[model samples]
Target: MKVIIIEDERPAYEKLVHFLKRYSDQTEVIGAAQSVQEAVDVLQQKGQQADLLLMDIQLADGLSFAALDQVPLKKPVIFITAYNQYALEAFRANGIDYLLKPLTYDAFSSSIDKLKQLSGTFSDPLQSIQDIYKKLSKPQYKERFLVKIGDHIHSVPTEQIQLFFAEGRNTYLVNGAGRRMITDYKLETIEEMISPEQFFRVNRSYIMSLTGIKDVLVYSNSRLKINPSFDFKEEIIVSREKVAPFKEWFGGGI
Candidate 1:
């Protein structure tokens, strides 16, 4: 089997290589990339020679999905990531298996075995992957959050939320009623739990809801400033890198 590895961490890459060798002496690693840009370049140049791709979701530059958006890969992929939240996205991108890191030999072997079995059984590899994806259940996003207020508990529906923001080390949720409540979940966790159609992470500090947005003004440095329905002390500005995606999300393209 000829494979390509896309991983940023050195130890993880070395461990993966060791496991591949243990799986079969005939298994050959044809290419390796450490970042999204490198992965794109490598895939464009040597992708045809690779029979399989072993990729990490997070890379040095950005997420591996960014590379997939730029390059069209036909080979089956096995995704390795520390976070389980990316499993749905992984499966959508020609993935046969999604393995969480701190990878075990048994897990690695099983994924390889499954790949071989499926390859031998199905003549159309892409169709097989699509069938497997259809069999897997879809991700269920959070519908409501339970917040404690002194002696009382409040169940806040996700649709009522205007935004989620991080202040210092703590995260807070703002509802449509202009009430602020502390949440245990970090902004990163909140980003994964909410429906993408309704919310977007504008910057590192803020995730804004579509219905809550009052105005979008062109800001300095090619960024965008967001005015929400509720009062917020700090300005909500979309990061320069995220500007394009934010626009797409706002336009319902994402």
Candidate 2:
């Protein structure tokens, strides 16, 4: 996947590059632009050379939405924004997923998967952007879950889960009451089932609830550490690259 990142902030761009290298090795970042006009020029010049676009809503020149009006971008786009207000505009303008500032690997990877799915169905690429949006917009996510415990099967509700964590190869669920139980599904499998508005995947091993985050502490490495309400032995640290989006999600970005 050849991607073009359009972000004005130096740190945010660097952070995304870092995570992309670690998680998404298959994706090659072909180019980057710091402003709206630059992005327009780059996209117009590259045309079909670029397979995907990671665009920022606010650019040095102006809104990215306005910039796209000046040129035709056929590649699938995944929007990046510091605020939630621009999300609606992104969707209308061929966006696959709106990643709030401080993009996490989980969210980024999920968006990539969505883009792949969209590409598989549509032949004209962005021509079916609106169609892809309408198809994926209303998905039937998992509402309730069934958990099995030694000889006794227990049912768990999505609202009660504080977070889902994977250890070694097994996935576990930490409920509202701080009880840990083994789950049959993996983190990747459950990630698709839950609503993004309520749960944010801060790292590879954990997908946490907005309500369960007790405190957000700045780590020594400049990343943010999530202090969950539950008694989790594993440290939950949101990488420096993902801290911004995590904060936005925590603040109710949706």
Candidate 3:
């Protein structure tokens, strides 16, 4: 069967290509695409000659599923995604099978077999694609933030972080022991990595950890001021809309 592999990572694309060549005589990869744009172009150029798509959920530019909205493709897709088991129900519901990353040749073959068994084609795949997109768009509740420090990458345990603040264009992470370190992520990106039970983004510039909160002082007109034990020149203020949720989060309503 003619196949198109749509994966963003070069190493992963090469590995899958090598394995496809080695694993099965039933499948033949006709073309390899690195991004949604590339896949769309190849599809528009090749049309129905491309029989199947070995797809990845996340791409370097954006989610791979978003490609469907832009390009009209009817080819069956067997998804390859990093382990996000929360999305399996939607995958199953949508009549598509997914292979978790670090996939073995046997597992890959079995998934293909399963897809072939279930009519060998996906119908309304974009609906499931939309569901996956919706789930991924929201904050994925993760436990820790991966912080890259110089040459070493560290998982700064979420509980150990005191506060996150922005200066100019960079964001800094302050830990419980009064140590500050530079983080590569922007404020909004880091916000998704933190657990809402213990962290709150008070404004566009700051996301403070619960462990760092020393006191909350009521300010003018229902606005609240946060006093963190860490040294700071300006007081952290909570917007009026955030006060209720902030209180609920701080009060352990997680």
Best by lDDT: 1
Q: Write the per-residue lDDT of candidate 2 for residues 99-150, one digit (tens) a residue.
A: 7655778877777777777663445545545544554466556888888888
Q: What's the distance in Å from true for residue 142, model 3?
A: 5.9
Which residue pairs collide, candidate 1?
A: none
TM-score quality measure for candidate 3: 0.53
> Whose TM-score is higher: candidate 1's or candidate 2's?
1
Q: What are the TM-scores, per candidate, against the unseen true structure?
A: 0.50, 0.48, 0.53
Point out the worst 10-residue segment of candidate 3 by lDDT. 86-95
Quote model 2's TM-score.
Answer: 0.48
Q: Which window of 10 residues has the lowest lDDT sum in candidate 2?
A: 120-129
lDDT of 3 by residue, 1-254 (tens): 78888898888888788777776767787777788788778767764786677888788887666666567666667788885653654354332556667768886777666666656555566765675566455654556667777898888876788999898977888887777778888988888777777789987788988889899999999899999977766778998888998889889987
For all candidates in order, the CA lDDT equals 0.87, 0.80, 0.75
Instruction: Compute the lDDT for candidate 3.
Output: 0.75
